[model samples]
Target chain A: MPIHDVNVMILDNDGVLRREGKQLPGVVELYAQLEKRGISNVLLSNNSRVTSDGLVRQMKQFGVKDFCKDQAMTSAEAAASWIRHNPSADRLEDMRVFAVGEEGVFRSLQELGIALANDQWDGQQWSGLPTDVVVGFNTKMDYATTMAPAWNAIHRGSRWIHTNGDVSYRNAAGAMLPANGAQLAYLSTTGKEPAAVVGKPNREMAESALRRMNVTQDQARIAVVGDNLTEDMGLADNLRSAGWNAEGWMVLTGVTTAEDCDDPSVDRVFQDIRQITRALLSR
Target chain B: MPIHDVNVMILDNDGVLRREGKQLPGVVELYAQLEKRGISNVLLSNNSRVTSDGLVRQMKQFGVKDFCKDQAMTSAEAAASWIRHNPSADRLEDMRVFAVGEEGVFRSLQELGIALANDQWDGQQWSGLPTDVVVGFNTKMDYATTMAPAWNAIHRGSRWIHTNGDVSYRNAAGAMLPANGAQLAYLSTTGKEPAAVVGKPNREMAESALRRMNVTQDQARIAVVGDNLTEDMGLADNLRSAGWNAEGWMVLTGVTTAEDCDDPSVDRVFQDIRQITRALLSR
Candidate 1:
């Protein structure tokens, strides 16, 4: 199905709206098209380095003045939200999380009033066992200092939760920098995957975005628009599997190219987000 | 087939001869039996934390008066030796090694006259690209401070070498501590195995020890004694594959129990090193 009939839009950041700090051509027009068509839009990013509010500020700088903080959902925020609504929410104050990431992860958890486990060692072991180990994208993490404590904590029975599973990200110079999943791979070598992943391809993030749009899965047609097939297209497939009428729109702007969209998950291919936006608004 | 006719003994340190800073029962007698029988012996340890000289001092403190540094081999020394004998040895003077390890690794490379690569980042990248990245046992390494440089260097085409592949090691309290291989697993997430591993199960270390014993593989009936099947028994199997008449003697004093010696690679099972030594000299 074409995205022209969809009333709700789920968009990926980084590659779709912008590439390496500069807004991609037609981003401003894409938002205008969404508004004119009365289609609710949510910006979803697997990047947990920046908070949703920070992303909104970034979007405003990129000339998307209509995008508000409420319209953005980060994996970090989704993870904290998941924890807050889970069965453990009854004793949220008592739950201790050992977090491994930068600003987005720390700030999101802090805002939710979740207690962070002490990382300092008391000569023998960690100060205390954590209730959960949350990992995000951390560029300054040290293996012996940061990872060792987390590894030992998990071995001692802490639940492992990861914000996203992006193996690599494209830097400004187009170099592939190791991402959150690469570090998670180090932790997973101890023989277990993370207990929960709240980013793209996971229904939790899509559901969180859909809830923000105030649209039920059965009430509207949804289209996920982005560049990478594994993340954006995978999310569309996951939502469709969960009974949502979702379609994937692949754009050739960052990381992926035209030849890479030969997958059944991708329902349409565009030169950029501008072309997709025009197609979605044409009907 | 029995060790009674074997003239060369390859022994694992730690578990067989000693346990937790103290010599195991009959360790001194076991060494005396080898000396009296005029059999050549080499103490091999996958531990890259201590140098061979340091191991000699440790053995001397445990009552092995005749033990010399030349009779000991650590993965650290073996790695350095491997670097010296390979085709890369021709440019030893021009080669710079980026070492991610402790005193044993640093000291061994320094003693071998190999220039150490500068790990200090000059804001953009490493001061200079390393010719080889040697990873050993390092407990104090952090991901950002230590591993980032190693990861970046490897991505830039530096040869990756590892001292050993032991995933976990038993600490003094018998608790398992993540070893060098565990850290290496983090670096390996970038999709490449190490170019060389100089420890157990690799024929290079065994060849280095055989060179020290002044014996050719065909000239001696060799018996490897250890409690771990993966390292010691695997080393015996490796040597046999390389045309040596090597036998594995599984001792029940350390990591492996008697019931675990059902593998065909384990030619004989002894209660301890003392019992194995007696069997080797019975003849």
Candidate 2:
């Protein structure tokens, strides 16, 4: 699909618009051009710590002032959205989630009217076992306090849901640290794999974005632009497989370097989002 | 090999002799029969928290008062022993280990004259990176304090050594909890598998026992008795493959029930260690 024919755009936050908490070049112009061309755009973030409102605020810091909550979707929020639409969900309020994550997971589930089962230990066992287990990234996770109870709940038949599948991420000091996927990998050693991973490369997150934008796959031409080849570009592949006209555009501002842009998942490669903006606005 | 011809015995502590911290039936007689028959015996434990001295104390409580540190081999101790005998080791005093485990791992490595690197963060990075990273089971392991530094160290080319690979273990309350294998699984998601897993079903621990017994594989007939199939019986199979006259004897007192005992790994099955004692003593 051509950039001019893209009626909807899914932009990855970390590398596409900003890197290391600083806005990259052309983020402002990119949003301005997208709005002028009447294209619905969503900022998709795999960082499960941030809510949609938090994402909007972060985008505002990145010179994306026009980005609103409706244009933002965090993995935590996508997990919550997926839960709300689960076929087993008879009453939204009746589902209790044992969240093994930070604030975004709790807040997103709370916003969806899903009750949270207490994750704290009572010295003997969990305060309460939950019906569902929602895992996200949390640096403070301990075995006795968080993982044990979550393991017990999952073995006892809790519906396991993962916000993302990123096994490692770069920290502030450029060191690779264990992420949510590591925790998921830990729990799934002898247990079940997560029922769904509502992050990039998984269709659930993109489906949530589609639902929020009020567009069906057949009715829209989608473009996924980001720096991560497996995450952003792989998402475009998933969308195209699901009957959407989606193209993946890779940028070199974050993880992917110029030498690493030969992946078939990427439809095209750009030096930065500035090049992407120029390409989209040329016609 | 027949029971009477066995000159060396490897007993798994968990199911063969005790369950949930209490000694099982015929433990005293089992030791007495082995002593009378002049059989060399070593109590092998996968628990990484206990030192050899602690294991001796544990066995004494289980009605075997003669059990000593030399007759016990902990996975933690085996890991330390393996490190001491590593082919790359030139100066034993110069090796610094970043240990992600409980007291046994620390004490074992320290006893072997291996220096410990500080795993604590200085609000910026690890206090010091290490040449080797040894992971064991720690219910208190948190990402920011333990796993993140460990992940960074491993990615930075630290020699990764795992104490054991039991992913889940039955806690005091009989509920399964995350164990060292789960930690190993977590770290190994996008990283290299440990350079060695110094636990059951691996030849390193058995070789350590053989070294301690001062017997060559061809010079002795060995029998490994345990309740778990993969760890204990599989160890017998491993030793056999390594040219030892070894046989796996399954006892129905631990993780394996009678219904689960039809595997080809076992040369014989007993109701418990009591039956083995009776059979060996009768002939």
- RMSD for each of the candidates: 3.0, 1.7
TM-score of chain B of each: 0.95, 0.96
lDDT string for model 1 (A1-283, tens) is 6566889889898888889877789988888888988988898999998999998898888787877888899999999888777734357887988888989999999998998885554434666678888899888776445676677777667788899988777555444456787777777766767788899989898898788778986677988988888888999999988899999988888778888889999888889977876676674
Q: How high is the TM-score of chain B in model 1? A: 0.95
Clashing pairs in 1: A142-B142, A142-B143, A143-B142, A143-B143
**How does each model score on TM-score?**
0.90, 0.96
Which parts of model 1 are misplaced by more than 4 Å? A86-94, A119-123, A126-128, A172-175, A280-283, B20-23, B88-90, B119-123, B126-128, B172-175, B277-283
Top candidate by lDDT: 2
| Model 2 regions lying over 4 Å from their true place | A87-89, A119-128, B87-89, B119-124
